[model samples]
Target: MNRKEFLAKLGMGAAFALTATCLGSCSSDNAGETGDVDFTLDLDAAANAELLQEGGFVISNKVVVAKNSDGEFVAATVVCSHEDLEQIVFQNNIWRCTAHLAEFNQQGEGLNANGSNGLAIYQTELSGNMLRVFS
Candidate 1:
């Protein structure tokens, strides 16, 4: 190839390489988490609202729904990773384990640094005021 044509191709190749490297690094930072887990609860037709308001309405052997600070609802697993005790308590927009006092935010993010992990969160959907959490 001519000298000018060779230089043009080299410059184009370098630009493409730089673009690929930037995109590669940016995507790698977000690779850890796939997505949030989901769990769904089917409340019985005669389910008592008062019981739900009191919290600790067990959806199954693995899940529970509780009201957050806004009175909106959220769900998480009742199983505590620390001691496998079902001690999840809802108060002030957070879920706390009464057994060991491990705290987690509404989105299931660990709020403490005491080696206590966050509760597992389930994605919620509302259908006519009925909240559905998928597992």
Candidate 2:
């Protein structure tokens, strides 16, 4: 190839390589844990207004807290078991990872190939507008 053509190809290849590297490393590895968790949310608080609606959810303290369609509270780690990425959220009354699309049930059991490791679940209790999530 001509010198100019070769240099152009080399530059394009370098750009592609850099893009790939950045995409891989730019994500946070904040998923997979926070041992011995024990926290509470006041249902009457504006920050937790979602809890008042069935099938709504919020993420706090590295945990994804949700109110199922049945108006019951459930909790799980805000991490995908497959890649340990903090992309877990509640949708359709179950846990889903936006990064890799891993899915888990309320019981923290994997529901798909990408969720093979399952998820870490927490115990929840509700009393007088207070919701407690514990390990």
Query: For every candidate structure, what is the RMSD over all alpha carbons to the true structure, in angstroms?
Result: 17.8, 8.2
Per-residue lDDT of candidate 1, residues 103-133 (tens digit): 7777777676321455677766877655677
Best by TM-score: 2
Query: Which residue pairs show backbone clashes in model 2?
Result: none
The clash numbers for all candidates, in the given order, read 7, 0
Residues 1-135, candidate 2: write the lDDT tens digits. Answer: 999999999999986875665455444333366677899999999999998999889888999899999988999998677677789999988899887677888888879766767888998999899999999
Q: Show the lowest summed lDDT stretch of 10 residues, model 1.
A: 25-34
Best by lDDT: 2
Candidate-wise lDDT, in order: 0.58, 0.83
Residue 33, candidate 2: alpha-carbon lDDT: 61
Please estimate how well model 1 matches the true structure, expressed as its whole-model Cα lDDT. Answer: 0.58
